[model samples]
Target: MNTYRKTFKFDAEFPFEYKYRDATSAQFELPNHVHDWYEFVYIYSGRGTFFIDHSFYDAEAGDIYLIPGNTIHHSYPVEDDPKRATAFYFSAAFVHDTSSVGEPFHYLQPFETAQSKQSFRFTVPEAYRNQIVDLIEQIHHEYSEEKVGYRQVIRMHIQHILLLLNRHAEETWGESLLRHQAAALPQWIEQTLSYIDSHLEEELGLAIFARNSAVTPAHFSRVFKRLTGMNVTEYVTAKRVMRAKEMLRLNDRNIAQIAEACGFGSIPHFHRKFKALTGMTPAQYKHSL
Candidate 1:
């Protein structure tokens, strides 16, 4: 498998979609939705909760969340005033899934599949509370200024949001740190993990990722296993075959095209792998879907 998604082209001259959310009192409401692309969300004031699949997280000011492709989530207010926040959404492949360098910034390793339906809260820091203000200011600046390179400038700010989380995630995760972010993802490794999700098409052999991450294959294997609680190969294979099922739901293309698009090497190979993963052929799965 190539382990890549054909990158999506954003409407660069303008924006596919752009908006800002701010509230002073307490207010939060979101219905469950599974985005086909990506979402970057940040909050400034008020307290609320985040619901991802099954988990419920306590949310507050200065919190940031990057919801990856094909994820189902919702939000509700802790109180009922005006909670402030800003969010951006676009195709997951809008950023780099892979390259000679590494995966794009947004592709974080998925929250555990078994754990997806659960919500976990994060801790917020007073210091980064100020930083979150700075980030949102810059994001709005790029959005408002619409400078010559504002498009790319927003992308850089988006990347900065994650980097800020990586740095302050633990300190701010006051109560929810362990339950949500976990030890496996420190900072850089967390980004590494997301790449695996974005690039599930390529062959995710341990050696390949180790080389990409600039870690020894053996060390990458051990560290990844220790952090994520799953070995490298297991994680990659599971995501690939499972995503194939969802792509099947669109039901516009034939099995071969679906197979290729989902990153399987060929139809026969995809068939074999599909049955192994789902205990049924792709045709059977399609009918069910």
Candidate 2:
């Protein structure tokens, strides 16, 4: 039972997964810098301007901007117009590994950068964008309510909202994929993840997890792979690697202990995966980063 759970200050959270709303300001206000994780800012009802990757864009209601991790970006209100926007943040690895391909949520990039900065951006269809806004507003409403096990509920809704973004992603690639066709993700992906974090060292496998997530092995594997861009086994490895990296950098645990704590079957396997993902091995990365 590996349950991953850690809380961060509102000001500093990465692999941060939450929805928030901000009121429009009369004066321009923004700081130019990148965070340790990714950010998605959705304009619900706002007239504003954004500076992303050194380029500018008009931020109107229904606009969603995808800001990659460590990619410089900032914002400012549109003169005196009232505005309301919501945002969510996480890491690329929070979504998938380096080897994973396919721009599932890449469509939200700010287009003004494409010509000048050569970055790709896509627009969420007006209809779908409306759906996303509704989802976020509902999620925030539920968040304020704090019903039973609200954390877990919000996580599920957030995942559902992500499924919407995932659809937009496919559309951006000129591929039309419906929500049901978006590839079913595990119902317990987040639950299983929460458990995984708490019991990182527990020996976990697909057989038991099949029951845990309440799906048959075949269906579970299919949905898990489609959503995560990795098979269950690979996803576990990636999770372990991320845990290892976090431990190595922030905790007092040494390499061997951290590897063991993160549930690597062996030290060699951990090191191998570490090197493959990062150009440098864990030891090298820790010292460098």
Candidate 3:
């Protein structure tokens, strides 16, 4: 199957779920997928390679991965031993809804940091390992018991867990958080992404992009690739293709119009790149839709 984005709709009654799972290497393999809710995994015991976007981690027991929604990731074990882990899934709505009672930012720091260039996977410190494990176990107990106000209880426990993780992130990362934020990428990359979206119909040249970023072309290219996992040209091409796809479905514009609207100099170039990235021609995709 073509690797496509996967969006999950959380049940209204129970917007959070957690469980302990044990599986062999074969069963551990999952597709390249993205979800609409946050997923936290604690590898209790096992050895595996965890794939997150263009990055991979050599995972083992006590390692934790905090994957934000819409990030593509999966895992594969390296050995025949059963890989055991506990997974917690929760939605952004759940976090926001519960923040009224307590400070959600206290628990959301690590997750927010993950959005930046910081690493998402970390090994639990020996000092806090038991405390973290016990919290997971308590969540599991609450899930299994189905007691009164169990959902509320789970949310409360999740808030506590987030606080613990945020504290750990602060202690472990320290001042480096600021450094990473500063050094992660040129601030203009974010601005450029927005600018590109707003002006897809206008001329978008590497020189212009470099000028907007206030950096040399070569330096801009290097930092863009390092932080975005794609070079400037590739990033712009992807965005244009995404815009064309949306226009194809939402507008009555013909293919040629879409090509121009998406800033493609030629319809043929639009067709080629669109097919290369989406696995289908623009015409086919629109018809399929």
Candidate 4:
């Protein structure tokens, strides 16, 4: 299986997008992929299965899945009972801008906590499901109509929806409504991922990871690929490129310095890998920003 990054182009002014899908839709399927925007999938009806990062969950009517950016996931409707759902996608900046300083509540707490715990599936109480649906419908209306001040209307509704979910999480802190599955990745693999992230600037290779994990390189490679859908080299290079993108956007670091900090051996090598993953040279990406 080939797991690739999925990219979306959002409007600079309002970086939020919405999609609704029903059984009759031609392509109501999700392939294994990761993206750079937070997402919410609300199941309007029917049933399905959702695969997120290291576990799978059974999805049904009234279910809501919170997917944080950069997490790999896939969803498919059941053969006998297809699912109909609405998806909301927005950027981190959108959430940050909506928040005020010294505010006690966080708009992204549900998503952030879910990502950390590998538990992405949840369902509100029966009484609140309608309200959730109503808010989402309002957002859809504002988005579709695009009348005067529609963007502000949509933003308010989006914030309201997030607030509802956050409150639900708070009210039912340890309830069964929040479904958490057993992690599918082995303990060692999980540790390896953490290690790679913290030590991105260090020299990284298959042999080093395998040796550190106390397994043969070939065996480690097979298990890693099977779980992540990417070979070790591919995963490492992708991570480095992602780190490079962040540095480019946030700092004034030159391309060569960023490349060195991101573990690429040379500027030419960095250029090749960055363009291969992101469809633009480093300079072009920076200029676009």
List model 4 lDDT by residue over 1-289, tens digit each: 4456677777788888878765633254545677778999898788766767656677778888999876667775676778888898998777665446776877888898787666899878877788888888888888789899998888778778888888887787836557875456577787888788778889999999998899999999999876665789877887788789889988999999999999999999999998876778999989987
Give TM-scores for every candidate, taking all chains together and pairing residue i with residue i.
0.49, 0.47, 0.60, 0.72
Residue runs of model 2 more than 4 Å from their true location after superposition: 1-19, 26-28, 91-122, 172-289
For model 3, what is the error of residue 178's alpha carbon versus the real structure, in angstroms, after optimal superposition? 13
lDDT of 2 at 202: 79
The lDDT per prediction is 0.58, 0.58, 0.70, 0.80
Q: Which pairs, if any, clash in model 4?
A: none
Error of 4 at 184 (Å): 3.6
Q: TM-score of predicted model 1?
A: 0.49
How far does residue 45 in candidate 1 sit from its true spot (Å)? 1.9
Lowest summed lDDT across 10 adjacent residues in model 2 is found at: 176-185
The superposed Cα distance between candidate 1 and the true structure at residue 186, in angstroms, equals: 31
How many residue pairs clash in all the candidates, one count each?
A: 21, 10, 0, 0
Best candidate per lDDT, number?
A: 4
Model 3 spans > 4 angstroms off: 4-10, 97-106, 175-289
